[model samples]
Target: MALNFEPELPTFVFERTYTNDHQFLFAFPNEKKMPNARQIQLRRLYDIMNLSVQRNDLPRARRAWSILARCKEINWKAMWRLGITLLGNDARVMESNPRKIDYLRTMLLQLPEERERILAELVQHYILAGKYRDALDELEFYLPSFPYRDNPVLHVYAGLLCIFVAQPPESAGVNEVEETAFDSNSLSRAQIFLEHAKALDPHNIVASEFLHKLHSISQGPASISFASHDSEDETHTKGCQPSQPKRKRSNS
Candidate 1:
């Protein structure tokens, strides 16, 4: 038996690598920046959300508001902040948290009842999130109270909502609807919106184009007639045919 004694490193100084016990205690601190709860519990959700936006941690940033959501007290400014931050990928996270539904409902409700652009955005957000039911609910929430926009794109927006989002019919299709699938439904709704848009702003190309495209996609005629704007192009005037390819008059 050989005995070699060295001064013990005082147990504290001595180091042990792996604990023979597989269950040795080890600890790690939570490093992930969890949404700060107390900060946004009510008045602070806006601040936390702003911080999230500053970091471009849009998902977690928006999630921060889940803390104080359902309040419905956040006005258009706050709602806009949250609504715009919602991106395509955020939908999954939103679906996971039931808080998402509350946030959206409150957000839409808070927007000025007549703010069509915000309503469009709200619709777009719901559509991206694949919440068709919610999207439809949004339309129902908005369409009635909305003052008709004087925008040229108004019809396009309305048609899209009615046919695709709102599920309108085809037989009542607009003039441009040539006949694609649900040609009748899409055309009809498209016609309705486009007509509305045209009625609002007769010379708007955006409205004209949307109607033209919808009808074209449905196999309808490619042209539409509308009065030109103040800065109108004579060649592209309403009812004017596309210019023919000019032939080069070259003689050998």
Candidate 2:
């Protein structure tokens, strides 16, 4: 009888076993169980891009990012920060490549969630690149919109840019009527923006200082020297220095 009967197997012993990876896949069926060819390629490119950036190999990083940007599966909107970093890696290089600005503008359209922040950054970049008119235009275009209209910092930037463009060039010969009209319009706009900024954030130092300067400018040439005012304004608005003469304060 002992020879004829075999020992009963336990129920657990008969159950199929799954590894951790299998369990994970089972838990998240909607997720990809394994990387497809495209995903694998993208992952490799991402690694290369990050490593190249870390190594300061901008060319290599740009190449990798370019590929990733073109891929259909890639969510470039989510990766906009990385794109900004790559595009702005070299300030000198970026100055020559206007396409980078265009690319940022394109991203601005694609990333609605980050629109305000991106627009602010884009305006700052334009200011740094000595494109005062362009920066002001950008602010004007967005200032009527939802979030930008309410943003105090953006109002300050707009106000500063207005003051900048209002200044008449020292060497340029132009029609007196046109110059006067332009200056009048710009100063008016600057006052409006600065007042708006002050109203939005009363504690904003930049807005308050600029408002005072604007008021002093209105009081006539004798009340405030343009050279001194310009220098003081530039000091308050960091990274937005206009391409103007940096004159020393006259000691009389």
Candidate 3:
């Protein structure tokens, strides 16, 4: 004879336990993790860019381009589109706010494949901002990467920057001896770069002109006067956007 087991245990006890377990699993999904975070981000980037272009909103475009640039892995086509948008935005930034030059540099570094082309634009931006020293530093950093053996134009810019950095603004009240020493060192450095530029390309008319002017300034008057090195940027394309391909979002 079996004892009355049904009365001892509640029939709904197992049902209650199952409900609690379901709630716990829903609250903390340990077994099933969310997927396609990158794809989702990329989709958002596309949407932002598309809307920005339709609205002709530069600020929005810039924000989206920056986000894409910072992404660790982006498709080649997406990266190219981002670079083009940023290139246009950077030109405006250079004209309005020169201090954002560092941010522009960071954006350029994000797209490694387009580094040379973007770096050339960056150098021009620095020149336009009256930052000769900064421009020279960038030019020197990338000079070795240039396809040519030596960039005579880059050398000319570097030499000009050296002269600018050496020449003290008239306001700094320094003794004649100190001024002479500082100017001498700067002139020596400038001479080295200019000479190298001439050696690289004897027919470089700009280098030749710079050297002639430098010599004239040196001999005619002990007073050092600087010339403007702000060069025009021909790479800037206003109101331009790269065509983006249709990309599918992962549904995983």
Ranking, lDDT, top scorer first: 2, 3, 1
Give the alpha carbon lDDT tens digit for every residue of 27-92 in model 1. Answer: 112212332222123323444456566666777765655533443433334445455455323433
Residue 130 shift from truth in candidate 1, angstroms:
3.2
TM-score of 3: 0.49
Better of 2 and 3 by lDDT: 2
lDDT against the true structure, each candidate: 0.44, 0.66, 0.53
TM-score of each: 0.43, 0.65, 0.49
lDDT of 3 by residue, 1-252 (tens): 965432122132122222212222112111223324343434445556556755667777776655554544434332443444444544234352344466557756676765655566566666566555556666655655544226676667666666655554545454642355335666677778888889998987666765775786577434534434333321222121222232333344
RMSD from true fold, candidate 2: 16.1
Tens-place lDDT digits, model 2, residues 159-220: 98787677655444545323343367778999999999999999998888888887877766
Alpha-carbon lDDT of model 2: 0.66
* Candidate 1 runs further than 4 Å off: 1-51, 57-79, 83-101, 113-115, 131-141, 144-154, 161-183, 217-252
Candidate 2 runs further than 4 Å off? 1-45, 70-74, 88-96, 172-182, 222-252
> Which 10-residue span in candidate 1 carries the lowest summed lDDT?
23-32
Candidate 3's C-alpha lDDT?
A: 0.53
